[model samples]
Target: MISGPLDHFRSGYVAIVGLPNVGKSTLLNRLLSTHLAAVAPRPQTTRHRILGILNGPGFQAVFLDTPGLLQPKYALQQQMKRQIDLALKDADLVMLVLDASRPDPDRGQVPPMLSGRKVLAVLNKVDLVRDKSSLLSEVDRLNKEGAAEVFMVSALRGGGVEQLKAGVAALLPEGQAFYPPDAVADRPEKFFAAEFVREAVFNLYGEEIPYSTAVVVDEFKERPGRKDYILVTIYIERESQKAILIGRGGMAMKRAGSMARRQIEAFLGRPVYLELRVKVAEAWRNDIRFIRENVYGSDRPSGTA
Candidate 1:
């Protein structure tokens, strides 16, 4: 969608809602043509609502990419659930993204929170489905499940994304753009720094290390005629986790920092000097106060964030 001087603009908030690890981040990146959301090979990689604005010719789609819906396992997970709920509350339409490569017994049922809003069931990863007959059957089944429409697309390869975006645009109410014409997102650069670092950790670590970590950007400075300086802290629940994350002589942390800095630089359209550190937050997943204070950057800080 191209943006020109618009006299009839269609704009609305579309919440990307789905189960854990359903490629919601990939779908968001595909829709916006930018890496506004973090992607990893794990559930719950997205913990916050990522708002990505797509300005087409006569439509402005404000996508609220939300945390996956799941049963809360701890305080941090509960907070994540709340973030998803808040996204649902503000959404004018909900796009239920699903992995077509996997079996979903609950595909027909919409969550209670989405009862009133319009829903569009998107069967992603269709490229992985070998049987064309089965894929069509699945679409027919989902269409019967009460979604306004069912779209088949491969978010990884950019297939069928244009049609889905068009379908989404046509449903929106006609109005002026919510954000500026040139704005891609409504967040500070520091926020995305933490997100890229978290994505790096999730990709590099394994065995509980990824889920046990929380990244917080302590200081972000933009220096003229110099690379951007970013100071980030990775909060873990135990000392053993910290040791694993840092590796021997800090090799693991160094690797993660280098990888994250490259991605951050690419996204920011400049150079970056990323410094990574680790701290033990001691069962922060279960500690509500600790999760709220450090993870969300609230008023309270016990020095671990």
Candidate 2:
């Protein structure tokens, strides 16, 4: 609880931008003190721009955890890049997260969109760094390159996160609060439900199964006095992939469903009856209509700038 005058109230969007596996989602979860975004080892795990709000006294920071920047190979990847573009357009400040353990520190280069914005270069995963001098050198190099400020922290271990939060709050411009203090995230429960299921698929499967798959919550019915019933359909590119997902005698599907159900239960704070089905959508990632409908959903209309 920070004490400040009404005139000093600050509220604005801070876009978290970075390359794949750079710990952007982990940093957001750490800042909000809740797991709003799904964390997995796989690249492009985050498909949408998730907004997490942090309110303290007179400040409210709307943090946008965006999809990792990468070269688009299909329509789905193009849409993912679009989401990042939108976040960049709406951001009041930008935080470029980088993997500090990498030998080449210059890889943390700022993107064209972030060129004139208030940028903070965050060197994440400092816990993995053994030499303190190398970390300082990396920070200094980033600072000299053009970042308004450079911060070193381990988002996974909660190290230097409090200081990062304080620094963000101080940099925000004075404005009205964008959301209620009690609100944690802007996305609905169903969006996270599908994400949890997709995460389970990524965790349970190997090879191309995770990348070639997408989870759609066909039905999410909540009963007042009973456990919630969620029906999800997993989309795959081929029948062979379907067999792999279902496994021998349906055991694989059962395991994945059980794991997803437990995750949903933990997230919703109630028991859930989850039903999963697999469907073949050949090269759906390259289909524009499917990408717009299933991936981005209706909230974000197609061709949005």
Candidate 3:
């Protein structure tokens, strides 16, 4: 634990922002010491803003794992951008996670929202770098450019994570804890259930199939002693895509379900009876009403499709 003054209990929101596939979600999970965010090698795997509360002896870090920054290609992508924007606007501190192994580390520009705020530049994937001098030079360049502080860490291997947490704890303002110590994340189990299914799709499929796919939990029933029952609907835009997801003799769907069921069961700490079905939604991503209700939840007002 990152120890600090017990009288000064600090708490604040820290938004993890970066370009796609920069290991933003992976870093969040590492910081929280648990898997609260879904991660994959593909870009744009995280579409929603996930809140992970990290509580230690005298500090609470409310970390927001947001969708990676990207140009809006469709209504769904636009909604994802909205999630990023909202996270930036609400954050007390911004942690910019970057892939340090990239050839042109200077290409990663800081967002306009982080202009005057306390920004922490996190150079992730340090384990991939062969030369330590080059990594130090890149860190110096980033710190000289704008970052208030810079850290080199390998999120996958838990390297330099404790120091990063200590740095964040020092920056956090004194206040009350936003969430209870035991709480890991703010999202419900059903939300993670849907995310687990979607993650499986991304891992199993190839090409544009994962990008066009979305999973919705139709039914989630929990029993006292028996295994929990879950019914999920996988939405796609075309009939051909549906056929590809289902596969010949339903083998592909079976593979996805088997992978997702094991993950969901681990997440919920119970056996899961998962049922999957594919349906063609005919460009549901372009429909504002559907995107608002299904993707971002119905609580927010519908925007232009």
lDDT of 2 by residue, 1-305 (tens): 22234458889899999998889999999999887788888888888888889997668999999889999988889988988988888888898999888776356576676778899888899999899577776667667778887888999999988778877887788898988989888677888899888888877889999989988989999989988989999999888898999999999999999988888888888999999999999999999988778877745552211
Clashing pairs in 3: none
TM-score, every prediction: 0.93, 0.94, 0.94
* Candidate 1 ranges beyond 4 A from true positions: 1-7, 298-305
Per-residue lDDT of candidate 1, residues 180-280 (tens digit): 98989877888889999999999999989989999899999989998888999999989988789999998999999998998899899999989888899
lDDT of 1 at 302: 21
Give a tens-digit lDDT track for model 3, residues 36-62: 788889999999888888887689999
Worst 10-residue lDDT window for candidate 2 reads: 296-305
| lDDT head-to-head 1 vs 3, winner | 3
User: Measured by C-alpha RMSD in angstroms, how accurate is candidate 2?
Assistant: 2.5
Off by over 4 Å in 2: 1-7, 302-305
Model 1 Cα shift for residue 187 (angstroms): 1.1
Which whole-number lDDT from 0 to 100 does residue 150 have in model 1?
Answer: 80
lDDT of 2: 0.85
